[model samples]
Target: MSSLRQALSGAGAVLLAVHPTLAQTAETSAPTNASAPPPLLWFLISMLVLVLLVFWLILVALLAWMRPQLRQIYDLPTVHDTWSGRVLGLLVGDARLVKGEVRDELLDHDYDGIHEFDNDLPPWWKYGFVLTAIFAGCYLTYYHVLQNGQLQGAEYAAEMQQAALMVSTTSDDPNQLTTYTALTAPAELSSGKSLFATNCAPCHGANAEGKVGPNLTDEFWLHGGEVNHVYKTIKFGVNGKGMVAWKGKLSGKQILQVSSYILSLQGTKPANAKPPQGEKEAPAKTLAAR
Candidate 1:
């Protein structure tokens, strides 16, 4: 009966350890749904509850079977002396020193001058150790085997993806500058040249001859050569292409200035110019406005 009780207790401990870990993993892996709980998660939870119910029923039956033997023990306390003592008893069960003294029979044989007592492990400490081991196993499997846990690289990637999504979503606001009317102001043009030299030179080339990006010096345009079209393309990038929306990184006014500088570069042939990409634009209506 004692062996059976020990077996049942160990099984119960294992069940308790696995139950929460399974639930947490299921919750994280399952797809989110507003209408109902994810099917996989619901199934796992239901199975866990059923297993727990079976364990509870077995425990109740075992207690009932031991009722006759329990009645023979006349030394049982009517009530714990204090709430703290009751709580301690609930955690550690009946494993404790009798009258605060060790029995001579409980001493073990001396080994190489060292001796030990055969004291039973406290239930709380034993269960805590078991839970720690279970957690360590689950953590190792999650990160190493399944690769589901968010390690440093994965976390950084997720953050970068979220940031890109935020940029794409916010760049479409109507309030943002989406039109470029060509700035003729000397100060604005100077600023625009500086901005272009720093940001666009690497791809478009320093002389706007084009290296990786389309040639700004030529009349040809990939998306349309109009001033407003160029401004819109710069602000909200060309999708599926290398051009990233600069709205998140650059101010609207700065983009306008950069567009103005590019406009200034048109019709002026530069050294080592790349051949035109798209159809030629009908020369943008004057460099002053519109």
Candidate 2:
């Protein structure tokens, strides 16, 4: 009893001595664990491995469960007699299965001892031919029988009529001169500036100093110097020259705005301006005075 008590007392003393050290170690490590974030890469890798393992197990179980069905399919006769087998064969275009029974009976016609078997067309081919016939019937009904859709000639004529209407609205006669003065409104000029920057900048330069097109700042005109003349030139661009006709693209009011903006740029000579190409014409002082 006395030895047992001594052993118990010794164990208690050891535990009491180690308790403070263990608590101190745990306290020191707790802050480090709380401060540091867990690594994400290892966690992601482990999760991917777990998912793959689960997928493989599922695949193996499915294959095991379907073993009997796979064996039955493998052992199926080449020429199926059942209705389900015939339907499957039809879908897959299996000759022997779709035909059901072999037609060994030769045709009555024989030439030089060579006989031909009267074999029917494949099921898939027959079905496809029927589908095409149905489509043709529908097409005939829609286009010819009821006349619901327009023919190519009629459609072309309709498009031409719309184009003629557009042309009639804007007079293209070269002799018909406009008396429109240069627009002095700030709003009109701002809209024209934006239009010029988008459409004309590539050829005429950002400041209309001219690159591929003529300089607008100089007192020289390719078509005409007057605002009305400029409007005509812009509306019906030079045919042989690089200028594209803006009649179909821009409205009459838009063309006038752009022409007015071009006139406003006169006498503001920009750097690296191109040499004058057309005849030197005096600026339209009367139009600018408006």
Candidate 3:
């Protein structure tokens, strides 16, 4: 223990001697004064705040000045002109307090045989009926003489012409080169399947087994069986046939993909096909075969 104490004393003296050198270094190197933050930072923040405050003040003043103008534009009534129900509940009453637009449909309920047609609809309410009648007159004038095609088959013919113009699939030889585009990718097939689920599944089953529309998987086709022919049948429906035109319901690309999928169903027959109604058979495409 005496030897350890002697060693500690020697270490303490060494440390004590080093402490003066450290103190001198600290005295020489320690910052006497720190630099103030850049005035530009404070200046930018102060300017931003001042600009915001000025903008706020300007906005408040603009709103205050425009208040009367806004009120005039909206036709807000002055205090004197504003409605305050009838004096002494006589000529002017709570019944009159009802808005000018608010009309009551008073049923024929009379107490003690005293019938009263007390207050009819306000002028504003009556004007709505008048406006409706006036519009009806204009409607008749515009539709009957000016554009009578809406009814009586003229409009129907015009509409058909418009549709025929839209389908631009023309041919050099009607016998060959059917204009329908074929869908080959899995992406196209998936999209067609989704579309069939949404549109045709309710009619035709999801797998094209017969439901409301005919089975597409069967070799037998009501209209025709080829991809292009199927596209045609889909685009412009067979006349007097349960199958309606799907041109508007499905886009051209969607129709092509669906037709391609249906063609892929060729040579495979489902359990039920409606006895092949149409005489036409699709031109064979070996590529479309499974």
Candidate 4:
């Protein structure tokens, strides 16, 4: 018995020592086990599904109980006379609900031995006709009698006037060709000179002599010699050439000033002038005649 007790005590000690290792191993594996969904969540989801199933069953049972009573109510004459009931009846293929009942009493007139029942128009059709008449009366009062709304002609005219105003305000059309004579006033010329020196000097040279661009001091112009032509060239640059469009960079007045300034540089004969490339323009007096 003592030996058996000693053996039992040794086994108990061994179990105590292994308990901590087992607990440590379980702790280490806890994160991996946590990947599975919790039991409580699954239980809650199952309960929700059970509740929905019960509710559906109850609803089905209640509908079954009330179906015969609902059919009886639907068959009543007073129910069939109502609009909603008539709509329902029509859906169920009962035309008598919407269309007036057929009468056995025939009219005096007969065509080709066929007797006429003389039934009234359908209720739905009569209602639609009455609604149309009401709409017509309201429309006449609003547009003609009260004169609160504009007629088609007046509305069209108003829209056209608005369109004209919008068009008048917008003048910067790149495709449109414009014409203007050279500015001769001393102040205007001075402004033009200042604008040209600041903007056109890099390419055309500070003295209007040719550099990377064509000479402005000469009568020869690659585009055109006229002041308006120079303005057009400055506003819309040549695509393949080095000329950059100055439309957004310069205002209309500023562009006109620069053009006038360039024209004034004509016949100045700047030093180291580039040879003329374009056809010579007519004399100023003759050009002005056109």
Candidate 5:
């Protein structure tokens, strides 16, 4: 004991001597003053954990309370060792017992000679109601009073804003090639052909030689023949010319693919070609400027 005391005293003296040196070194070095997040964040985390723990405890207690009843059910001759019977037992406990309990629940007062039973609500229903109340209270506190989360309207607006940003970024990409400059792969052309067959064939004819609409398989175009011009014409459409705007029906990529397909069809002679409806071809820049 004396040796241990002497050793502790020596250690304490060494610590005291080293303390000043350590403090001086620390002061000379960079001061690490990093702080943790706000206490409210930790408080919310703790509350969530507490709520989960409480729910767990409640579930365990409910299961423990129901054990005896379950055992009784399992012991019944009809339900013994049968999965279906066990399920039925859990869903709707012994009808005979329920009927007997209902008799005891009879209320003395009668209205219009009709006796009312003061039976308690089913356990499953009551528990569900209690859980709903708890959920509502928590939702109100977190989303409204404390302002910890966004409401539905705010969340939707935020998502819409994010979507618009994504669209703007994609549209503004300097190196992003349009279908006219980029498309050529066999698969991409095939996709465009399929889209054209499905959407554009009805009015322009299956081979795009003209039916109710102008011939697509020719150099002459009612709208300008430039890729961007064709793209805009398809997107906006001629208001009184019976061509409905396709932009709302098709995505931008789909529109580009279909436009590229139309470009591919130019200069081919058709059996029954429609007469040219617009002015003779002009330069791409001039057409776009219009």
Candidate 6:
């Protein structure tokens, strides 16, 4: 027991000496200057890598899903060797290029998963494009440059004003094929009035007072009162509304004269006239004011 105790005391004395030296060295060492970094940065880097890997996997999956259908509908070609192909290459920015040295091998091309045009662009498409260009050029020159045109602004306005004036000034004259002097010619109206009295008086009364057919000369012609409307009624009579086409019965000239005569009754009053039919015109004075 005493021997065992002596051995223990020696080991304790040795441990005490070593502990002081270790403590002094630890105090001088400055906390090992910094231990190696934590594994957390590695874990973060691993997680980033894992997320990227998962993203790439998803992208690959989507591409795989659509690839088969796209493959059937279209053949994905590598860069080609034609004019359109060159344009596409220009648009895409980097395409396969062939030098003079490579041209021979390129020409000897078998189906290396790419194709090229063996024929030229269609003749119709080429000519059509040329025609379109020419047409565009002509249009630009006419509208933007020369201004000599099918319809110029001043000329069109002048023509319209002239036409409208012609229509209005000689409105009563159906056949303006001659001068306006023919307006007062008796031959023109005598036949029309005669025809109206004979054919139309039986239905409408002698003074064109309404009985069977509506009144005429009473500021109210049944179908219409204007020269054009009257002429139309006489020429192509209404069927359902009891007017009949008179083109065959009366000459076009006779119809025109009758239309003119009806228009002339603008101011003349008839006794016991039927009330005004269609849209009434303003009294001539009001019309003139307008």
Candidate 4, which segments miss by more than 4 Å at Cα? 1-170, 283-286
TM-scores, all candidates, are: 0.40, 0.40, 0.36, 0.40, 0.36, 0.33
lDDT of 5 by residue, 1-290 (tens): 99999999999999999999999987766444333445668989999999999999998788778878776777789776465554545544544322322445668798998888887665566678899999999999999899999989999999987776666435333223334452556777688889999989999987888889988876667776777768777777788999888878988778777877777776667678777777667433223322
lDDT of residue 35 for candidate 5:
31
Q: Relative to the true structure, how large is the alpha-carbon lDDT of every model?
A: 0.76, 0.81, 0.66, 0.80, 0.73, 0.60
- Report clashes for each candidate as comma-separated counts: 0, 0, 2, 0, 0, 2
Better of 2 and 6 by lDDT: 2
How much is 122 displaced in model 1, in angstroms? 75
Which residue pairs clash in candidate 5? none
lDDT of 5: 0.73
lDDT at position 161, candidate 1: 76
Winning model by lDDT: 2
Q: What is residue 163's positional error in candidate 6, in angstroms?
A: 28
Pairs that clash in candidate 3: 86-92, 203-212
Candidate 4 vs. truth: CA RMSD?
17.5
TM-score of 5: 0.36
**Candidate 2 per-residue C-alpha lDDT over 131-188 given as tens digits, one digit per residue, 9 for 90 to 100:** 9999999999998999999889999999977776665443775446777888889999
Q: How high is the lDDT of residue 108 in model 4? A: 95
Pairs of colliding residues, candidate 6: 237-244, 237-245
Q: Candidate 5, 38: how far from true, in Å?
A: 53
Cα lDDT tens digits, model 6, 183-233, are 235787777678777766676656666556775655544554545556667
Instruction: Give one digit per residue, the lDDT tens place, for model 4 in 14-133.
Output: 999999999999998998789667777899999999999999999878866876665667688988678677665654456776676766778999999998887888777898999999
Instruction: Give RMSD to native, each candidate.
Output: 26.7, 17.6, 17.5, 17.5, 18.7, 34.9
- Name the lDDT of candidate 6: 0.60
